[model samples]
Target: MKLRIISSALLMIAIVGAGCVSNKKFAQLQTTYNDLLNQNRALDSKYQIAQRDLSGATARVQSLEEQIASQRTGLAALQAALDKCLNSTSQGNTNISKLVDEINASNRYIQHLVNTKNKSDSLNMVLTNNLTRSLSREELRDVDVQVLKGVVYISLSDNMLYKSGSYEISPAAGETLGKIAKIIMDYKDYDVLIEGNTDNVPISQKNIRNNWDLSALRASSVVQALQNNYGVDPKRLTAGGRGEYNPIASNDSDAGKMKNRRTQIIITPKLDQFMELIEKAPEPTEGAAAADSTSGS
Candidate 1:
């Protein structure tokens, strides 16, 4: 529209100048027209740049709106899930309570068993310590007092306890056996197991046919001594023979054979007490049973 207006103005100027206008005035009008035309071209270029900028800005705004919509949708889904979880927790509160009660009951039973085991271990340790403290250093050379797995084991070498290659109790064994028996009598609740071990050598005696006979006879002799001579309860004593099978060392060497020929007096809690404890085990609480039923359902 501006171009057409400018063209009409220039045509009017040419018509008027053809009859009366000077050459200077015509040149001035022509210069004014050229200035206006240049200005209009610059304005057109600016308009095209502004249109591109507006289109880009609109596209960016649209992208941001889409992102905001997606985020809102995600937030709604998470809120719904949280509400469902809260509802479930409220409805199943009784089941949760029952489970907690069951856990507490189990913990209590575990503690009870642990206490029983610790008490038994303490008694065994006391027995071992008392025996070790009572015997002299020379006696200890032939005796080994140890507590293994809550049992007191008094290992007496055959050299100190018996005659050479015989199950007969040595005359020198009297004092040592007396001391041991005294300790055994002090712990009335513990049962004594007299286990006899022997070396791999064969026995040639007419009465003792083999190592098994020697071992059994040796164990029986010790048990009899504890009962008859030292006043240990006969009911609390048990005799067993390992023969040459349960060797502490190799019997190929003389020293090893001597080590292998030894007797172990094992003191432990009564098996009947352990059986009683097993029978008295805690029964399942009502809460525990209810919890199991709920879980099964």
Candidate 2:
């Protein structure tokens, strides 16, 4: 009976020891679980902070990309503007060169016209001097010699050239006509026109109707005398008449009537010279023509 009691006491002590070991192992496991949970929370917080930093970096990158795109657009616009400005400058240079050439051509043409006029004036002066030197003072009283607009005019009184109230050439007129014809023959390039003038008085001659007929007949007589008597070329002579018109003086007095009853010999250069000058004239530019018009006004 003592052996059975000792066995029962030992078994009870083993049971108590087993129960204490189980409680200690369970507490250690709980402590390990709490530590693991705290580590997981800390890791989650770090991951959230990292994610926020990444999001901020992404937003900055997007902003930088947008600025770069806007800068590229502005650069393209500036390039287009620069190219347009360069092209316009080239065109402006071309226009300026063309304008300079036109101005040079116009200046040359103006100088040519001025030179031609000077030569014409010199020739007219020489012709006038020669005619004056050839005629005597007494003969010049009955004749009026002058130069007008590059032409020579020799006006003779009716009394000196014809018989009284007649178209017939007088004996005294031969010396004067011969001397005048000699001077005309020296200038082969000149053309001659014989013009007759009459007073307002009515004619009483036979075969002569009115003043027109008388004046025309007188002009014809002078032209015939130059061609037939004075050995002048008929092709170079033209006959015209002013019956009671183209008078140098009034028809109210006797002296004025005498002056009106006269004949004129006009000498001039051929028509071809004038035509050549006209054909050589250059076409004017728009700017030059406008300037010329403004200056003329």
Candidate 3:
């Protein structure tokens, strides 16, 4: 009876130990499964965040592309308008020159936008419009007016301005000068350069010795008229005598000689921004300067 009781006790202990081992293995497996579930949830959350960012980035890129395409279309339309304005005539309407200038300025602004990332060109546009309005016309029979790069050039026939072999301006010429003076007075921010040119013929007067002297005296006479008669500020005027050096036509023909004898009044705007841009631009080489010297400014 004692032996049987000892064997039964040993069997009960083995069964209890087996039950503990199986429960320990099941607890370890449950902990591992919970860890894997947590890892999968974290991975899914990261994927959703990445997808949301990609969608936002794609929308921004598409918006930028649409804006660029719209800008290109606007630029094309502006270019066409500029071409039309330049090709049109400057008759019937007195404000045609001003219109053309405004169009040109608008085109330039658009071009600037296309070329660079910058702001407004309002001041330049206003100045150009004022100048165009003051000048008014391109052709005046004996006078020709042209504006380029914000400078105004008025070329008058010497025959219309002066008598034969005289530096005196005729009464008829005073009317034209009066108009010019009014324009100058209206746009008070310009500096005037009066350039006198002559034909190849030799000149001999009581005080004038040569073509240079004649040209100089003629230019001085005009300046005096502007100051004394029309009240143009003397400080704004500069006189230059080109003589027969810068001729527009051949000296061999009478008609050509007539065309060669002219006086040029160059009106330049006094804008600091324009001067700064010009200063920053690349200087012309010696060869280019020589070629340009052949032409009148």
lDDT of 1 by residue, 126-182 (tens): 655676888875676678776644456788999999997787798899999998887
How far residue 137's Cα lies from its native spot in candidate 1, in Å, is 1.5
42-160 per-residue lDDT for model 3 (tens digits): 55545543564355446644654565566567657645654664566653133334444444544554454434322123333355445445432322446655544456677788888
Tell me the whole-model lDDT of each prediction, alpha carbons only: 0.75, 0.71, 0.66
Give the runs in model 3 whose Cα sits over 4 Å from its true position. 1-139, 271-273, 276-297
Worst 10 residues of 2 by lDDT: 92-101
**How far in Å is the alpha carbon of 43 misplaced in model 3?**
86
Order of models, best lDDT first: 1, 2, 3
Q: Of the candidates numbered 1 and 2, which has the greater lDDT value?
A: 1
Model 2 lDDT per residue over 1-297, tens place: 334444554465466557776776656555555555555555554564356435544664465456445545644653454445446766433344344444455455555555545564566556667786877755766776666445678888899999878898998998998888887787667899999999999988889987888788888988998889988999999999889878867999998899899999988778885455342556767754554453356
Backbone clashes per model, in order?
A: 0, 0, 0
